[model samples]
Target: WLRGTRKDPPTLDETIAHENKRQQLEKKPINMLPTSYGRDAAQGGTGKCSA
Candidate 1:
């Protein structure tokens, strides 16, 4: 019969699981860089600093 031959699509739970797995695999780490001014404020081996 048509009904028996047709396959059902993924359910809500299956969809959520697939999405979660995809997100986990596509995750990336953040890269940070300090500004030049920030580096200057650190002082060049002066050992004196102010916040």
Candidate 2:
């Protein structure tokens, strides 16, 4: 159960779900931030925002 040996991080769906839940719990608009930058993005693995 070590950090390196553990499973990969949550999928995009899970991340989005968690973000949505957090937003709802706080009762405020969640100012979205980029999940990654440059060529190392994780936003669906596209690494670029598309509107």
Q: What are the lDDT scores of the predictions, listed in order? A: 0.42, 0.43
TM-scores for the candidates: 0.41, 0.40
List clashing residue pairs in candidate 1: none
Error of 1 at 51 (Å): 55
Q: Model 2, stretches more than 4 Å misplaced?
A: 1-6, 28-51
Lowest lDDT 10-mer window, candidate 2? 42-51
lDDT digits (tens) for residues 1-51 of candidate 1: 013353886578766765565455345333424454345435531222111
Candidate that would win on lDDT: 2
Question: What does the lDDT come to for candidate 2?
Answer: 0.43
Instruction: Encode model 2's per-residue lDDT on 1-51: one tens digit a residue.
Output: 113454888678866866675455346335633332312332333322221
The C-alpha stretches of model 1 lying farther than 4 A from their native spots are: 1-6, 28-51
